[model samples]
Target: MPSFINNIVTLALASLVLVSNVAGDKLIFRNRSDQVRWIDFTPNTDGTNGIGDVRVEPRQDVEFSMDGYGPEWDRGRGWRGNFRAHRDGAPREYDHIVWGEVCFHCDSQHPEFNTFDVSVVRDPNTQEGIHWMYPRGDPGAGLSGCDHFPCSTCYVNSGDNWQTKTTTSNDIYVEIRNS
Candidate 1:
């Protein structure tokens, strides 16, 4: 009888611990940039679904709570990533926008979003960046992909260019802004 009582107490204690964790944990993001940007998420915690593209307006933020992780020892590996801006423009610029991406790599899983350590960047050779810039405001770290795609072939468009730039953080929430 005593052994059965101890087991019940153990289970009750475990339930309380799990409930406390869920009640107290949450992820937060702050977007301080002036332009709209996109963010993507890949959680090792949940291997089933990919958190798709997220659009964050300037000075806005978003967040997610930590869902229960997979049963693997490596679940919830750290997350960090690159940024990009896309919009209508010359053929090369448009093509650059369409192709601008930073891909995450994985094993036994589809590749995830590549995390970053250094400042936000635009590498033409790697074909990744937030390369879209206004005629007046240019961050300058972008692909000259425009040089390759003829401006004449792609109709020029004066539409809003959207981008997603990531700042550094721990294994939890990630900042989604250039600043």
Candidate 2:
């Protein structure tokens, strides 16, 4: 009887951990540059839908929240995508970022947690630009990309672990700088 009771308690604790891991997250994008920019999210090949492009003006910000569940996709469970910034009349920028990306109950080794990251793997206009992102209040928890073409903190390749994962609720912040 004691062994059965222990098993029940362990299952309860595991369920709690899973709930905390899959909870929704809030994202805040701040444009500190000198011009307005539009941010677009291209969902991963998983078929998860995302909101339309977001517009943030200079010295301004926008907040978005997503439930880390449902909206079934081809391969994953939650909404996942890469956000790219673009100028009004100019071309699309290559610096990209992602937030609230998790494949629920997948990848035991990685533990599907709400993750965020910035990348410059395809930075075409790397001549002069800076992009960074991190969980609010914890600058050390995130990374910056495109500061100088191929920054080590940025995801320049598939082997990079620039992505930040969170188990607790927090605000993810992103900043775009054009020079």
Which prediction has the highest lDDT against the true structure?
A: 2
> lDDT for each of the candidates?
0.34, 0.57
Structure candidate 2, residue pairs in collision:
none
TM-score of 2: 0.65
Taking the tens digit of each residue's C-alpha lDDT, what string does model 1 give over 89-126?
A: 22323333322222122222432222222112222232
Tens-digit lDDT track of model 2 for 1-179: 99999999999998876565445455677777777878776666454555677787878887866454234542233455666656655565434322223223344454454466666556433633237666666654545554554656666666666444443224666676775
Give, for candidate 1, the lowest lDDT window spanning 10 residues.
Answer: 129-138
Q: Mind sharing the TM-score for model 1?
A: 0.39
TM-score of each: 0.39, 0.65
